[model samples]
Target: MDMSERELHETFLPPFKATVDEGVASFMTAFNDLNGVPCTGNQYLFKEILRDRWGFGGMVVTDYTAIMEMVAHGFAKDLKHAAELAIDAGIDMDMISEAFVTHLKELVEEGDVSEEQIDVAVSRILEMKFLLGLFDDPFRYFDAERQQEVVMNPEHLKTAREAAQRSIVLLKNEGNVLPLDKNTSKRVALIGPFVKERESLNGEWAIKGDRNKSVTLLEGLEEKYDGSRVEFTYAQGTTLPLIDRSTQKVSVTEVPDRRGFAEAVNVARNSDVIMVAMGENYHWSGEAASRTDITLPGNQRELLKELKKTGKPIVLVLFNGRPLDLSWEEENVDAIVEAWYPGMMSGHAVADILSGDYNPSAKLVMTFPRNVGQIPIFYNMKNTGRPFDAEHPADYRSSYIDSPNTPLFPFGYGLSYTTFEYANAKISSDKFQSGSSLTASVEVTNTGDLDGEEVVQLYLRDRVGSVVRPVKELKGFEKIHLKAGETKTVEFSIDEEMLKMYNIDMEWVAEPGEFDLWIATSSADESNHLEFSLVE
Candidate 1:
């Protein structure tokens, strides 16, 4: 990506800076190149920004075969040159690449590389090993009995369940169709490809996890509601495409004999409510899983259309790794819950949300686009010269003729079983002076009958600057619990640090200008805001 220096520091580098601030122990270099330089061999990134400017003392490691891949990136002539470049760029470890092991010795002997550089890299690795107590006791982490005891202990599972519950985002709930009433909605139909799926529950990264231990959605629901009280029906509406990775060319094909659309519809027709689990299979995402179309894979969309014929309230429960194109589901489905691969406790956590045992408090960290056409969509985007106006449609403006410029769901957006209202937003001062801080506060009240947690978000916009700025940037957020009919005040401290950004000259500074601040629910929220100015 050809990122400008301003964009690199302001947008892309903040997260890495944050990790460095938090004192992360290690960092793995990216496989891709920035501009024309591969990250594994980019001196500007590893040496200048990460080490010199930020003072990140952590060991830097290359991604799997990333050091050797510099040849493919055309940044290096061969493995020896790639190894030399990576080491010179401050890479302390080479993952899955023997380039460093094989070529470093020869390069040093040939005077192409210095012995001191090798010593520095080895010292960093040894420092990390010492910190991990590997030198003190190399076999400390190899206790099989301890590993077996704590691998899936009850306490760990409980924490996993809670984490899974909090990670669930309630995207859309038309007419409050969610929190399925067990007493009223007796016959519940659990339909779709993932009804009893176990292998995909832990997602792509959980290679060591035992799939058999995972509790399926059907199993969780059955355990939550007794069979005597709430009758349950199950149907595999469709089967996911089988991915064969035995050869160099991966083949994805549908199970020839497992289509059960008719049976699923028949079951849905008899049930009062339908909980359809649909999304990409675990393998459809993660490494080497790039796709042009990020919609519900397989015949699942067709299956949903068939189930809609029953006229039952469909609660679409998503299980996937990345943001999906949920344009049709958002419009057609009664309710939508983004339960992104909730690990081993996926089923129990999802069931808790569905049964109203837990109110979802998790907000989306990433923006979900309405369609794949809006691939690079985000909340903190710079308002171009001809910004799109919803009130006044113009062909010259930056927008799509077919769809709105807005996303399906904005960043920091999540719904709750209970409703929240933001009121009385205020700033401690009208003008902020250098070295002094201001408090931005707002009153959040739980208006609904159920008690819930609300993530009060704080966003800021620099109206004018030497360089163009984002329309809004999230500065602070606080997740507070409010009881039914309770109101709580949430305050955020805003200092010059929060306002600092790379100027036109690429120097980090806070320019004196008019700024807009909002203490609201989500990035899309524009209801309550305060205008302030930074003075010289």
Candidate 2:
């Protein structure tokens, strides 16, 4: 993708800058080209910014066959040219690409590449190897006995369960339908593709995990409720279309076969509540899994629509790697849970949340769009010249005629069993000089019946800037727990450092301007904001 220099530095480079600041020892080059130059052969990125400006003394490795891919990017003529370009661009190691090993020596001999460049690359790799003590004990990390002993130990499993519990985001809970009543709801019907599936729970990146050991949603529910008190039934209402990477073929159409629809509907009819486990199969997401449509794949949506006809409360649990088009699910489903590939303890963790054993405290880091049309939707976006006004609906505004400009669920949004009320938001001062700091605080009180955790978010916006700024930027956030009826004060120290950005002249500085601040629940929250100014 062609990107402006300003966009590159402001939008893309900040995270890399943070890694450099944290003294990261290794870096991987991307496969894509930036501004016509392949990342593996991008001299400006490697030499100018990474090495000279940031002083990153790390070994740079090419992503698998990325050096050779530079030829496909048209940045290099051949394998030899690619190797020469990579080494000159400060690349140290080649991952699964024989381009360097096959052509580097010949290129160096022909004077197309220098001995100094090769020496520098070798030294960086050697430095990392030495740091890792690989030279001291070559097979130190390959102990099969120790691996088996620690792989899925009790403590590790407990930690995994806790982590999975915290990672579950409660996207919707209409009529307080969630925290499913195990005691009251006698018959629980687990329906959809993921009801008993275990392999996909480990997700795409888990190469060595034993799928048999992983817990399914069916298994978790059964373990959670007593057989005498609560009876759990399951139905595979739909099957996810099989994605064959080798053949690049899908087993089913977008609206898959409806053979299991009848059985699934029957099961739901006999149940008190229907827990539909659905989402992209593990292979449908993660690396190399790009899609133009990101709705519920195959027959899942059809199955859900059928289940809705049963007049039972449906709790939709989503297992996805990315944000999805959840507009239909949000409006129709009684409750929605984002259970993103919760690993081996997926079932147990989900059961914990559903049974109210654990009040889910996880907030969404990514925004969920209403549809795939809003592919690049985000919380922190610049307000266009003609921003959409909900009060004054105009055709000329920057919005779709088909859909609203807002997301299905905004960033930093999640539900708790309990509710928290924000009050008494105040700042230390209305104005502050550069280099000085100010304090912003707010009081959060648990206003619901159950004790739960809430993520108090702090967002800021520059009223005016040298360049346009995001309407709202998340500056700070704190996840705090409060007992029912308890109150706590959350304070955030704001300084010039938090306000720094690349100005019009491309210099990193905090421009003197009026700023708006909010201490609220989510990025979409615009209630009771305070205004402040930075003096020159």
Candidate 3:
């Protein structure tokens, strides 16, 4: 599960790893109401899960619409009882369910709930209210408080800006026309309908965000230096595809026209460099979005080829959520930047990188395969009887014919403004006892024009096992900073359990055998392996 607030509480770890209090906490039978209603009106969910396992002593908020939905869950006598049971159960806030704000204290005085409990809940809520500055000033966050000033703060801009550049996947850089020297080209063409819109800029589930004020790529370029000298033209290559029927009760903005694609190609005809923006909209791939095909939308695939026909240096900025099928763009475009909805003002973030205000260091979080056929492929998984081998053909092995066994872009792949070299790997002890520790060390050097950082990864592979282990497991990793020509040694200490494998019965065990320890820059990169033996 992701590191969300809710997940930080509900999802329990396997019992073998549970803490002392967690071990003591046991699941109980589903209970009905104290008399005739459901136990949701009961005070246990908050008293235990909140106060005990989670240590969430602050306050408990009813899930949205929960107090109102209590009549349906059949826990309360009415909205009144639902509100009463909730507050008595230590629920502190009513989030849109509205009833708790209406019927809490009356039930408390009726002796249904102890006044102390009400005070506890009220004190908790009021404390947060005070911390929010709601009680002290009530209007502090809104009144001349610089909401946009902070939202679009220089630091946030820098992060979004740096992230956009790093997440860019340089699929093909044929001529090296990139790192575009402003002196080299006076005129450039920024083409694409998405050059302005941000429906997909921050992707889906972006909380409390808007696009009307988002700085578009064109706007970013114009805002940068010498806007008067840099001759630039823009065209709508093609409109983002639509479903033909309005879904929003208040209709959303209309998509532009696709016929503009040919005109966009014409605009790029004589420019020194061409920057083409391509990809899906905000509603395209987050949350409920499940695409049957993850490819560039509309005629943009064909549009890329036409841009190539112009013979100008081309840089493609691709915006998408999941791994896209980019074989065509990878083949034709000079460079492809995979900008995954880089948040508000994502366009300005792009301009920051293109202008070389920041360096790229974002590694890919998921594998970008050549196509959709290789779906659900990830780095951390179990080893199969016969892992998919492309060189040596196999019938029963897990593989596909039309596609290669490997991802087009493997995991932990990212490029920086500089380069790094890895060497001199060593383990504290070539021999590690079952209960002892093993230290893996590697020296890394940054050999480039500018200072940069690299996330050196350490992986372990169990050669022969009672239960098969994956080809590699990321046992440890470290992010190190290095000067342009400096080197540093990184070491990872491995305890017995970190090197252990789970058996068929899910028992943690480490059998005496040859284990290969790897220290590499990335998962697919060549790693110097040292053989270590774990004794019984």
Candidate 4:
């Protein structure tokens, strides 16, 4: 948490504010302590920041065993005191701690805690129950017949497929190896540990999903070309350890079997195009599954190395819960599709994107590091006093001798079957009053051969401020669709509200200064640059 107050207000708090604006019901507090105070017992976070500043009227719940673990942080004397601190900090519910149920009553009787505080928590909890219509009919939502009708209905499945397609980010497409014609392919090799699996497709947190009903990649592709001439061959080249759900840990042995490597490479040599599905095992990511090695697990990358010898165009499809280090695959593979555990309809959605039925338009929300060493890389990072220079390399500059100071893929980065070009960026005025609105517009042209969508990103930077600001901050964005050779003008409105930031005095204000604005496809690129000013 090496961030200033301004950084917290500008970067970390926007998404939470957005959820509150959406009328979300409740919020679960984080586990880590802010500064020295445990988040579960931090009055500043729950009371001052969330309740008072943000006007979040919903209930606040602690994470699993968070209150009981306050003793580990040495902030609480014991379980009883921990319970009092948590309740007093505006936590309305304690999850799995039993700290409240055990000690809250005793604390109230001893005058260590007030009954009014308990009443407030109880009222918020009961209010949620009433909002969920539990009092009207407790068993209303438990109808087995209704569950059957809604679980995997055709319409519901279609929506899931569309969502999966939208979430799939096309990372790299060298030589246009994708958009493979299903009819033209004589033989297609679909090799990976995940090719035939069904459960992992639903990802973690899929509590009630029926894995048996979920379609595998092979099933979905076969369904697409059932009446056609394409044939699909698959091989599981490697295997990783399965996860223990009770402990939320992966169970892996010392030895890994690469027995199927020869078969997979053999299939690749004969096939017209090779589609390799490889990445983190379902349980290798997600909650309580942190890993020091963010690279591909097991012999999967080794399998890719062997497949590369065949010299066949490979479509690398990844299923991960977090951004992975793909420095090697980025250089070797022909195309990359990042589909992060694409739910029950994952296969169908991926097939749609790869087959060109759906042009990929989704962009990355997080930065993909070159390797594990570039752990905290992001697009909106500050311009250091000694920024790295490729042309003028020096020891004092902030850069790794082993790697460049850039991410493998920056945030908002994605590829489509088509391409877009940005030009003619214009601002409404060169100078504006402090509290006035300004418009930034740009022309986006789809110059490729197919219809596609482009996310026009608008980034701003205060040239100088009372306090240091990030090198670039995403102010606004618009997603627009354009047919081949189609041109569209996208516009964004910026006001005093967007320009305000917490200054050195800890007061939010907009300083009169020169500002740099950029319109681009991704945050990394400066497709168009314009200068504007705010006058006092």
How many clashes does each candidate structure show, in the order listed?
A: 0, 0, 4, 0
Q: What clash pairs does model 1 have?
A: none
Tens-place lDDT per residue, model 2, 116-213, is 99899999999999999999988878989989889899999999999999999999888887887676737878888898888899898998889889
- Candidate 1 accuracy as lDDT: 0.90
Which stretches of candidate 4 lie above 4 Å from their native place?
1-3, 243-254
lDDT of each: 0.90, 0.90, 0.70, 0.88
- Poorest 10 consecutive residues by lDDT, candidate 1: 248-257
Q: Candidate 3's residue-wise lDDT over 1-536, tens digit each?
A: 12322222212333312443443322221233333434345454456644665565465565557676678876666888788777666676777867856776677667876778777867877877876779778778786668857877889877766666656554445665455554554678888757876566777777577766566777777776453456778887777765433563212455444577678778898687898888887777765567778888666777777788888888888777878988777777777777777776676777766665555556666788788877777665567777776677878888787877677777777666677888888888888777888788888889988777777887787888776566777777777778889999898888777666555555557777788878876677756788788887
Q: What's model 1's lDDT at 353?
A: 97
The better-scoring model by lDDT among 3 and 4 is: 4
Q: Candidate 4: lDDT of 8?
A: 73
Which ranges of candidate 3 are over 4 A from the true structure?
1-94, 97-142, 145-172, 198-200, 225-231, 243-245, 248-258, 311-313, 462-469, 500-514
- Looking at model 4, how many pairs of residues clash? 0
- Superposing every Cα of model 2 onto the true structure, what RMSD results? 1.5
